[model samples]
Target: MSVFDSLVGQSEVVERLKSAISSAKGGSSSQKMANSWLLVGPAGSGRSNAAVAFAASLLCSESGCGKCRDCQTVLSGTHIDVERFNPTGLSIKAEEVRELIARSAWSPSVGGWRIVIIEDADRLTESAANALLRTIEEPETHTLWLLCAPTLGDVSVTIRSRCRHLQLRTPSTASIEEFLLSNTSIDSKAAAFAARVSQGHIGRARFIATNQEARSRREEVLSLAFSLTDIDSCFKAASKILDIAQNQAESENSERDSQQMKQLQDAYQGTGRSLISGGARAIKDLERGQRSSTTRSVRDNIDSALLDIATFYRDVLVIQSGGEEILNIDLRTEVNEFAKTSSPKRSIERIEALLEARMNLGRNSAPLSTLEALFCALK
Candidate 1:
């Protein structure tokens, strides 16, 4: 298998990256030939994974053969040539962006492409983005900038318009299921459930399949969506949603803290605490990063779970109209009952209500308040 193979349902993007790496072999390395590339896609749509795979392709002789020493190192993120930046806070700072630009100025030591993959480039603050734009405008030889964002609108037009664009769509259920089953130890039945619940998010699918708690939380949330038939019931469902969101966020944040401790241990080696002020500084920095990550995770999880609920209503509409393809067949019985109770108009209204809440949340409304307002509106 190749690294490209790991990017499920993104054949077009895989082909484009392959072409770029292949052309670079004979073409002028530094003539400013669209060295910057923008990949826009929804959350959980494999945008970051695509950027990493593309970076791996440029790092290898035959386009990232998965078993090659180079590919293995790059995929595991230990490669020296490929640098990945996943900013933890809501904003990527100017100093950090300047550092990334400076790193990109150096030539690859391994006589191959030096790729910089910036995940969530959209989170760059205005100053940080300006710093990055200067580098992209005059990139060094053998350097490639792979910028991943949720949408072009999230990034400055000045930055996005200067780059080659590759947009990724959410994969189909069958594709997600195939990817999960091929990559993990999940059984077919489990893979199907994970794929359905995740709605094409590869990372979420893996989490659901491998973590029983996450799977149970999803089941419970969907059940609440199904049972919310009246005013009191809607409020109850909203409370459950808030609880699930918090629990998932709390658990994930705790796990990340544990992982940070392990990383700290590796860095500290045999040094005593009194002797390692740098280690203490690193821990404080890490905790700040982890806190920001936790906030983002909570918002992300709530939005995805809310979208799933909206999809349930969409499926209810499909079931009511006898559309040939009803989504969320995994909950056919509940969806059918919902279809029976809601007029197509009511179902449509319910979906719009969810979408409005999403917009409100995007505008910086609190998640708990958004959920309550949405549920109250539905009631």
Candidate 2:
């Protein structure tokens, strides 16, 4: 098995990357070997993993044989020449890009090539991206830049034109299920359920399968569709959903935030006492970055809830239309009852309302009011 084995259901992409590595190793002067590459895919589609595998292939003498020390270190993110940046804050600043550009000019420390992987290239600020344009357009022969973004449009045209583009699609449910069963102690039934409900997100499927709390939370989110009876119930549901999302986000970030602040304090301990001398501005900047990260986390949680809610409605529509395969197989009975009482047109309207609510949330509308309006429409 090669390091590319983990890229489940992406055989075509695997082959393409392998061919590029072979051509480069053979000194064939193929166009497949490029200084910069852009890997575009949906979230959880394993774009970062693919990029890492490609980097390992470039560094390994045996071309990513999976057991070599070079492949292992690269995959584990300990290789000196393979630098990865995954922004925890809202955006990648220009300073960060400038530093990366400076690093790109250096020769490899221990490997055949120096690889830089940016997992969230879409979060680059305008100035940050501009700072990268020249470096990406004219990088050293032994330096390769791999950028991962959700879509091609997320990157600027100039950068996109300078790089080779590779696209990955969501893995099939069976592929995800098989991967889960092979890797974890999860039973076949639970694995199948998680795969279906995850909607092609392999990481999410594994998470839901392993964590009972996550499964329970998903059940609660799905139950909202069946509980919408009156206006008061809709409002209550909206509040409950929003509160749950916010609380989850806060809980997930609280420990990390505290640890980061502690690290900052430790770093500044022997410097000075006063705010002006001790670098209070740095703490304030950290706080601001944490706030931005928290906001993003909350929005992401709410968006996930919305997707679950939408999936429930989609199941209703599928059942009403006599479709055989519904996404929520576990909710078949409730889906059938709802389908009996609902018309196809009304179900489509509800789905449309959910989609519009998602769009509004993306546009930075007030979350509570937007969700309340959405639940009201469902009622």
Q: Which candidate is the best by TM-score?
A: 2
Q: For each candidate, what is the lDDT? A: 0.81, 0.89
Which has the greatest lDDT? 2
What are the per-residue Cα lDDT tens digits for candidate 1 across 1-379? 8888868888888887777776776544554336899999987889998988888777778767878878888899988888999886657899999999889878887756788999999888888888888788778868899999999999999899788999998988899999889989989998988887677788888888899877666667777676666877877777788777777888768976898788787768766554166777887878888888787777777887788788788888887777846656678888877788778888889889999998887666888778888987765
Model 2 off-target regions past 4 Å?
Answer: 30-32, 67-69, 90-95, 269-276
TM-scores of the models, in the given order? 0.88, 0.90
lDDT of 2 by residue, 1-379 (tens): 7899889789999988988887778756645488899999988899999999999998999889999899999999999999998776667899989999888778999887889999889888889999999888888888999999989999888888999999999999999999999989999999999999998887888889999988989899889999999999999999989988888888889999999998888777756464567558988999988887888787778888988988988998888887979988888899999888889999999999988998787667888999999999998
What are the candidates' C-alpha RMSDs? 2.9, 2.6
Superposed by TM-score, candidate 1 places the C-alpha of residue 312 at a distance from the truth, in angstroms, of: 1.5
